[model samples]
Target: MTAIKPVIEGTDITSVEVGNTTLKLKQTVSLDSLQELISAVENFSKFFDLTSLGSADEGIKTEWNEQDLTQFLSKETREDQIVALKVLSDKGEVTREEFLNEMKKLLKNPGFRGWDLGGLLAGLSIRSRTWGYESPYIKEERREGNEWDTFYRIKERYAPLIKKWLKERGP
Candidate 1:
């Protein structure tokens, strides 16, 4: 496993961790892009602790990062999001049918296990229309499959944040 540390390059560029790799990016950013970058950094700084992010539970975990998970899943919808992610984390490659069945079986909340639950399964694009939310994990494959058949799986770029979160939070 690769390890990275804080590197001060120019006045702007800050190194980011892409997996265990150190990505030192120094480039010009458009005004809009700069703003977005600042917003993202500010948002990411809220975790209070980043040291234990991907290392604490490395023995068994996916590539999904905990910060990214929290950013995508709101408290109200986190349970649903976790259920879907958990299925992918366990099965690796799966279809929407498998996802739906696993969700029905894993979702502990009675109110969220309704037939309508599948619609918000991934909060992804449906019927070829954008839903404004796409998981870094499997956004394209988990689509409602209006344009084509669906395929789902955990993203390779992410760390094993899902399994760690579930173990810590229960179910």
Candidate 2:
């Protein structure tokens, strides 16, 4: 078996080689990027509806539900956000304001600094393009644009951090 290895070439560069293929990424990673990367990998299974891709009984639907929405939104509380910041920080020493600023960048919501639960729900709803008073859920829109590309790039750059976070979070 060929062992794949990933290397951090610099503060803003990472490279991974597998068999005959190599991938490289360059990005200034932040705590918010790390957190977003972790969340993306952790929730990857919920991004697709496998049941709809094949025989209805052959595969399970992995779409996010109301419970998932509730759990996600619950993490927006001040205390929970603080915990998230601690988890994402290098030494658990980041301030609440800085954490909130990073979160705003991660979520691409400029108004997130002042966001409460209602604002968060509203922002998520708008981003998901649900357009109405409804629970936030992932939609079936194809990922595009520089934002999505940057997300994947950051994910690649911070795969190790994401793995560590996932391990700490447990199964």
Candidate 3:
């Protein structure tokens, strides 16, 4: 059997080899910046399937109804909510204003015992910054203000190293 190498391994900083150049990534920084995006994309596929079920079969129309919406709201974490919102926004089902309005309505409903609306809203606002959405409630200041900023900074810092590695591998 051949030996298998780990992609990332370290205590504080992780060493990852893209092609030939090995780059050091701060474990906390990479996880903090990219974990949500990674999770959102992963869960998005499932969320799409769930939403598509309604369109796939007439019997499944009820699956996307108020109760289902309530359940989704109640169960989804902050990252999931962001993914859901992004999916909805992409589908043109709701704009940012409509999403916020719906959230407000949900917040006022006593029956909707769900995740904290404030945290969800904050997460949404922060995620929107990278896509150029302006929110009155959330302001992303500098490099450290938003997760996207952190992701960008990390990518920028590592691009040279990655490029060098890539060059070592010809087409």
Candidate 4:
């Protein structure tokens, strides 16, 4: 039979060993001692003032560190915008002005960082011709004679790469 290990608290015999069994001797513990033991068990089971037992501090710490996503807001990327546009377009058929208004409102949110622009555009451009806001500065960039063609070409190239990245990142 395996050797049993008894538990001692100072001079008090908390538990006794008989063959391979450990029998608890002090059934009525002091309030402080009971609270401590309960807290220790709640903190880490198998803790009976035994030096051989391990602590669960790391596991508890990790479990506590996970983010609470209920408070988090989803960010924007072209991909996300595109996807949003697609879904919104399918369900309600919003006008360009309405869509831009919604996008503007979404952009103002603290959590709405521009991350999924490609997906956003994929979802957005089908029913719309403009971004959320009209800018005199941006108009020059989209002009035919301007170097904005380079920017447009770059985005055209960006689609496939973005699609691949989003696929790897998952829905």
- Expressed as tens digits, the lDDT of each residue in 1-171 for candidate 1 is 223344333443344553453333454334435557645645655653434454212433333245645544434345566677677778887776666677767775434443554566535323112323334455333223123345777566542665566566675
Model 1, runs deviating above 4 Å:
1-68, 71-76, 108-118, 122-134, 139-148
C-alpha lDDT of candidate 4 relative to the true structure:
0.35
Over 1-171, each residue of candidate 4 has an lDDT whose tens digit, in order, gives: 224444555444365443433444435244446446544444442344333433222122211111211111123235445444333433343433344445556566444433443334434332222322211001011212311221212123233443444444556
Task: List the global CA lDDT of all models.
Answer: 0.50, 0.37, 0.35, 0.35
Which residue pairs show collisions in model 1? 61-160, 62-159, 62-160, 63-158, 63-159, 64-158, 64-159
Candidate 3 clash figure, as a count: 0
| Candidate achieving the largest lDDT | 1
> Model 2 segments beyond 4 Å from truth?
1-91, 117-171
Rank list by TM-score: 1, 2, 4, 3
Which consecutive 10 residues in model 1 have the weakest lDDT in total?
Answer: 124-133
Cα-lDDT of candidate 1:
0.50
lDDT of 3: 0.35
Per candidate, the number of residue pairs that clash is 7, 0, 0, 22
Candidate 1 vs candidate 2: the TM-score winner is: 1
Write model 3 residue lDDT over 35-128, tens digit each, in one string.
5533443464444432222211223212123333333334433543533343333333343434455555644543332245445555644443
Per-residue lDDT value at 145 in model 1: 19
Writing each residue's lDDT as its tens digit, candidate 2 over 121-162 gives 345444333322232221121113222121101122233443
Q: Model 4 — which ten-residue stretch has the worst lDDT?
A: 134-143
**In candidate 2, how many Å is residue 120 off?**
8.4
